[model samples]
Target: MDIFSRPQTERSPLIDFDFANRRLRIEGESYPEDAASFFGPMFKSLEGFLADVSDETRSAPISVDLRLSYFNSSSAKALMNLFQMLEETARGGVPVEICWNYEADDETMQEFGEDFGEDMEYARFNLRVLDTDVS
Candidate 1:
C-alpha cells in the first residue's frame, strides 16, 4: 500500500503511516472537535493494511510510535481502538511493536503510556522517554 500522511494541526496530531515500510508515527496534541472524523481514515487504512498482510509482509515487524502531548477523552478512546487492532494483528502471528513516547518530566503522560502498555498481550509495547518536552 502507499504511504498515508496527514500534517499536524492545532487541534490534531501528525499522522505518518508508511505502510510499505511497516512504520507508523503519530505526534502532537489531539483534541479534534470530532475525534472519529479525524481518526477514521487512519483506522480504515490500518484495517486495510491488516487485511492485506501476507506471509511475505509479515516477515518484518510493524512499528508504531505515538508521541502525544495532550489528548481528550475521545482521542484516548480512539487510541485504545488503534491499540486493539495492532494487538489483534500481533496475536495473529504478525510482528507488531508499539512505542509510546512521552516527555521525561511529564509524569501524567508517562503514566498514561504505562497504562496503555499494560494492555498488550501479544504485541510488544514499550514506554519511551523523550529527552526534551514536545509540548
Candidate 2:
C-alpha cells in the first residue's frame, strides 16, 4: 500500500504512516477544530493496514513514534484509541513498538506519556525525553 502522509498545520500534527515499512510517526501539536474529522482517515487507513497483516508479514516489527508538544482532550482520546488498535495488533503476534517522546522539562507531557504507556498489555512502550523542545 502507498504511504499515508499529512503535513502539520497550525492546529494539527504531522502524520506519516508507511505501511510497507511498518513505520508510523506523528509529531507536533494536535488540536484540530474537529478531532473526529481530523483523525477519521487515519483510523480508516490504520484499520485497513492492520487487517492486511498476514502470517508472513507478522514477523516484521511495527514502529510508532509520537512527539507532541501539546494536545487537547479530544486529541488525547484519539491517541488512546490509536494505541488500543496497536496494542491489539501486538497481542495478535505482531511486534509493535511505540515511543512517546517528550521534552525533558515538560512534566505534563511526561506524565501524559506515562499515562498512555500504562495501558499497554502487549506492545512495547518507551518514554523518551527529548533534549530540546519539539515546537
- Which regions of candidate 2 fall more than 4 Å away from where they truly are? 133-135
lDDT per residue, candidate 2, 7-47, as tens digits?
99999999999999999999999999999999999999999
Clashes of 1: 0
Q: How well is each residue in 1-135 modelled by candidate 1, as lDDT tens digits?
A: 678899999999999999988999999999999999999999999999999999887768999999999999999999999999999999999999999999888999999999998999999999988877457
- Candidates in order have lDDT scores of 0.94, 0.96
lDDT, candidate 2, residue 4?
Answer: 88
Q: Which stretches of candidate 1 lie over 4 Å from their true place?
A: 133-135
Candidate with top TM-score is 2
TM-score of 2: 0.96
Per-model TM-score versus the true fold: 0.96, 0.96
* Whole-model alpha-carbon lDDT for candidate 1: 0.94
